[model samples]
Target: MSDHSNNNNSWHLSIVERKFLLLWCDFIIVFGAIFLAVILRSTISMDLFLQRGYFGIIFLYTSLTVAIFYIIDLYNIFLIDFWTSIVPRIFIGVALTSLLVIVSSFFLEFLALPRKSIVFMSVVIILGMMLTRYYLMIVKRYPLNIMVLGSGFAALKMIEDIKKSGSAYFHIIGIYDDDDRKHGKEVMEIPIRGGIESFAADIKELRPQMVVVSFEKEIKETWTDILLQCARSNVQVSSAVDIYCKLFGKVPSDHIDALWLLSGIQLIRKPYFIFKRFCDIIFSLIGLFIMLLIFPFVFVIMKITSPGPIFFSQVRVGLNGSHFRIHKFRTMVVDAEKRTGAVWATKGDNRITAFGKFMRKVRIDELPQCWNILKGDMSIVGPRPERPEFVDMLKERITFYDERHLVKPGLTGWAQVLYPYGNTIEDATEKLHYDLFYIRNMSVFMDMKIILKTIATVIGGRGGM
Candidate 1:
C-alpha cells in the first residue's frame, strides 16, 4: 500500500479543529499570564494562590477574554492577517476584557487584581497571543493540494471563491473532466489534467490529499466506483457542496440541487426544538422588560422628532409559510412606505427621521420584536423573516428560498448578524445562502453564538436599515 493509504484522516488540520486548538491555546496563555502576574506581584506560593480564589478568578478572566476575542472575530484564523487584523483586534479585545473584569470585580471582591498586575498581565497576554498566531500562520503556509474532478462552472466558481477567501489552506492542483475538448484547456490557470477515464491512474500520480467531486450531472457508476476506491484507499473524497459549505459557512444556492436540499436538511432532535422554545420564551420576556423600561424615553423622542406612530406592524412570512404581524419601533415617517408600496429600504432614505437613524444604529427599533417572539411568531435566533411580497418574489427567483420558513423567523439571526441589510434581489439571494445554512445547522449553541455576534454588532453600531 502507498503512504497515502496509511491513515484515514487527512494530514492537514480541519478548520473547526484549528479553531478549537486556538481556543484551547488562548485559554492556557491567559491562565499562564495571570499566574505570572500574581507571582511577580507577590511572594505567595502556589498553595497561597489556590487559597485566594485563584481558580475562580482565572476562570472568570479566561472565559471573558475568550468571549471578547470571539465576538471580535479573532478565532477566524483563516481570515486574519497577523499585523493588520490580529494585532489591532487583540488590543480591542484585551481592553474590553479588562474593563469588564474591573466592573465585575466591584461586585465580587476576590476577582480584583492589583493595577500593576493587570498592566503586566495585559502585556504578557498581547505578546503571547501574537506569538501563538504567528506560529499558526507559519505552520499553515503550505496549502493542502486538492484535485477537483470536474471542469464545470461550479468547479470554476468554487476555485474562484477559494481564492477570494484569501486562505492559504487549500490549493487547487488540477481539474479533471470527461469532456475531450476541455481536457487540454485551462480554467482559471489550472490545467484540465485529463478525462474521468484516467481518474484512478491520475490519483496515483498526483496523490492529492483531497479530491473534490463537482460534477453537476448524475455521476456514472464507474466514476462512483473510482471515488469509492479512493475512499477505501484512505484518500479524502468530498462533494463540492460539502467543501463550499465548510469554506464559506453558507450553502451555494446556485450549485445545489433539490435532492441535495432534501437530504441535507438536518434532522434536529425534538428535544432541541423544545429547549430552543423554552429559551426563546425566557429571553423574549427579558427583552420585553428592557423594552418597557426604554419605551417611555423612546416614545418621547419619537413624538418630538417625527409625527409617526410609535410602533410599526407589517405582515411577514413566518414559520411554514404562515403570515404574521411583525412589530418594530417606527423608525420612519408614518406614511413612509405609502408611495413605494412595500419596497426595500434604501441607504439614507429621506423617509427616515433623523432620530430614526440613531435608533436603527443602536437597534432600538428591533426591541419591539420581543412581542412577536412572545407571541410565538418568531424565535430568539433563526432566519430573519421577510415581507410576504418579498418572500413571494424571492421564492420564485432564489433556489431553496422558502426553506428558511421551515423554522420561525427571528429578531436576530445568523444571516442578520453575518450579512448586512439587504435592499436588492441580489442581496436577498446572497443572504438566503446564510439562512439555509442556519436552518440546516440550528442548535442552542449556534443560537448563542449568533446572539453574541448580534450584541457585538449592536455595540459597534453597525446595524443597517
Candidate 2:
C-alpha cells in the first residue's frame, strides 16, 4: 500500500495534502484580493485615504472570509474545476464577509465601513481570483503523464477524455498492448511503445506519473510486472475507471463495481448533510417566493402559448434509491412521451411546445423544483434527479449506477452544470462521471460552486435535461 502519510513530492497529492493546499490557496487569494481591493477602492478609485477604523474593519472582514471559506472547504483545490469553481465560493465568501461589514458599521461610530467599497471589493476579488486561476492553469499546468497498457476502444476513449480535459498535466504518453499488429502501430495518435515485456523498462525510463492497466488477461504477466514496477517506483497508478473519474469527474457506468463502492471513499458527510438541508430550506423558500411573485405573468405567457397545467410532475429517484415526484414548469405537450416510451429530448425536440422550447433552453422549466427542495425530496445541489423508470433500467445496464443514490438528488448538480444535457445511454455514462465526482467530493463549497456555475449555465442558455 502506498503510505499516504509519507511526505512525498509526487504530483499526485494525498487527501490530507489536498485539504491543506485547498485552505492555503483560498487564504492567499481571498486576503490578497481584499487588501488589494481596499487600497484601490479607498485611495485610487475614491481619491481619499480610508480612516484607520474603516481600514481595520476591512481587514477584519477579509479575515472572516478566510474562516467562511474554511468552513465551506473552498480551499480544496484538487476537487475544484478552477474556472467553474472559484467565483461562486468567492461570492459566498464575499457575501458573508460583507454582512460583517454592515453589522460592524452599525456598532462602530467613527469607522463607517463604506458599503459601496465592500460590494466593489467582492466583485473585484471574484473576477481577479478567477482570472488568476486560469492564468495559473496556463503557466503551471502539469499534464498527468499516463502510459496505458492497452490498445483498444477503452484505451481510445481514455486518451480522448484526457485531451478534452484542457488540463496541462493530463497526457497519454503511450500505449502498451501485446497485439502483434498494434505493437508498432499508433492507436488514436498515441504511439504503441511495445508489447507487455517492454512495459516495465519503458515505465522506469519514462517515469510516467500514472500507469493505466486496462489490458485483458492474455498479457497478464507483462502488464502485472509493469504495474508492480511502477508501483515500486512511486509512480501514480490508475485504471480506465480511475482516469475516467479524474479527467471526466465521475466513475463510468461500464466500470463501476461493488469494490469501488466499498473502497472506503465516502464523499457525503454530516456537515454536507446539515448544510445541504439548510440550503434546501433557505434557498427553496426564496425561490418559491420569487416564483410566486413572477407566476402571474409567467402563467399568462404559458397559457397563451400552450394549453396545459403550469406544473409538470414526474416520479424521480431520490436519496437511497427512493422515489418522489419531482416538480417542474411544463415544458412539453401532454403525453409527449406516450409513443416514444421515455425517450430523450433532443436539441430541437418536436414534443416541446413553443414556450417549452424557450423554457428548456433557459432552464426556466426547472424553476418549480424549488418546491421539491422545500418538500425534502430534493436538494439545491447534488446528482440531478433521474426518473424512476430510467434509474431502474440504468441500474440493470450500468455498473455503480446505484452509487449516486447514496445522497439526496438535486435540482441542479455537478453533472448538470459541467456536462450538457444527457440524451442517450452514452451521454448518461459520460454525465455519471461528473455525478460521481460530486458525490465523492460533496461539500458546502462544492455545492456553492455548482450553484454559481448553474447561474452561468442558465445565462448562457446552453444547459438542461
Candidate 3:
C-alpha cells in the first residue's frame, strides 16, 4: 500500500535500524509501566512514593528491566512474522525481568512497596509489548523492492533468506546476472533480469530501493563501476554477505575472502581485549567458587561411576598457534582415546559413563576450564578451543581454520551456543560459519548474548556429547 519506489533516501531497513526502533519502543513501554505501577499503587502516590526517597527506585527498576530484556535477547524481535517470534521473547523478557526484580528486592527494601503493583506492571509491560509489535506489523508498513545482481549460489542463498524473513518488509522484484545461460531462469519465483551492465539504467527503470551485489566469482571491473555509479546516486547497494548475515545470523563461509576479513574484523580494539581478559578472570573466579561448592559431590560421582580420575586434562590448541592443557571434570572413560586416538565423541559414544553424560548435558564437565580462563589460555567468550590433533586435521580440510586462533580460545563460545555439539567435519564446517560471524562481530554485546544462550542450553540439557 505504501510506495517508496522513487525515494532517493531509500526504503532499506538495516539491522541497526531495527534494533534502535525496538529499543525506543522498549524504553517507552518501561517508563509507561513504571508510571502505571505508581498510579495503581494509590490514587495519587507522589507523596507516598517520594516519602521514602525511593524516586531513584523507579529509575533503577526501569533500567534493570530494560537491561535484562537486552541480556535475554528480547530485542532480536523481527517485524516480519512478528507473532511467531516476538511472543516468546516478550514472555521470557518479562518473566526474567520480574525474577530480577524479586531477587533485588531482598537487598533493597522499599517501604510500602506494593508487590501486587509490581506484578501488575510486568503484565502490563508484556501486553504493551504485544500491542507495540502488532501495531508495527499491521500498520504504517512499507516494503522495499530490492534486486540482486548475480546468479550465483550466494545470491540464491540471499534470495531464500529474504523470502523467508522479508515478507511484507522486503519485496524482491528481480535478479540480474551476466550469465546468458541464466538469462531466463527464475530464483525463488522471481525472474532473472539478465545482465547488470547498465545497473544505473536498471535503477532508473525498476526503482528498486536496494541493489545487492552477489557475484560468486570475481567481480568484473565494468560491473563494479556501474554499482559505484548507482551508489553515487544514493541507491542502497549492499553485498550478498551483508544481507545473508542480517537474515541467517552467520556469514557466508563459502563466499568469504581476505577482503571481508580485513573490513569486518579490524574493529577489535586493544581496550576490548584488555577488558575482555579482565572479565574472564573475574567471572572465572566466581564460577570456580561455585564449582568448588559442588565439586565434592561431582568428583565422587564421577570417580564412583567412571572409575577415572576426578579431573580430565587434554592438549588443546590456543591463541597464536600455541597449545595449552585444558581441564574439565571427567566426562569420559580415562582412556577414551587409547584405542582410537584423537577421535571426537559421538552422540552415543560408549566411552561416556552415566555420570559423564549427565555432566556433559548440564555442562558441569566444562566447569574446570575456568582454571584455563584464569591462566589466560582462554577467554570467557571466543571460539571454542579444539584439540591440536583435530585442529591440524580441520586446518587441512577447512578454509581459514587457523584464523580462529587470532584470539584466545573460550570455555564456552559463540559456535557452541548457536550450533549443537559437532562430532563430524561437516558439523565443524557449519560451526565455523558461526565462529567467523562471532569473530567479525566480536564485542561486549555479542559476548553477553553467547553467555545467555549457553546458560539456556545448559538449563535445557541440550547439545551433550
The lDDT for every candidate, in the order shown, is 0.78, 0.69, 0.76
Q: Give a tens-digit lDDT track for model 2, residues 238-324.
A: 677666665555665554556675553453457768877987999999988888887897799988988789888988899988889
Error of 3 at 463 (Å): 4.1
Which one wins on TM-score?
A: 3
Give residue 2's lDDT in candidate 1 (0 to 100).
19
Which regions of candidate 2 fall more than 4 Å away from where they truly are?
Answer: 1-144, 147-156, 164-168, 175-186, 192-240, 262-267, 334-343, 463-465
Q: Which stretches of candidate 3 lie above 4 Å from their native place?
A: 1-31, 42-113, 135-144, 161-170, 196-209, 216-235
TM-score of each: 0.77, 0.69, 0.79
Model 3 gets an lDDT of 0.76
Ranking by lDDT: 1, 3, 2
Instruction: State each model's C-alpha RMSD to the native.
Output: 6.2, 7.2, 5.3
**Candidate 1: which stretches are off by over 4 Å?**
1-133, 138-140, 196-198
| Highest lDDT model number | 1
Total clashing residue pairs per candidate? 0, 9, 0
Write candidate 3's Cα lDDT for 116-206 as tens digits: 8778878889988888766655564445557788877777877777666546666676788888888777766877767865455667766
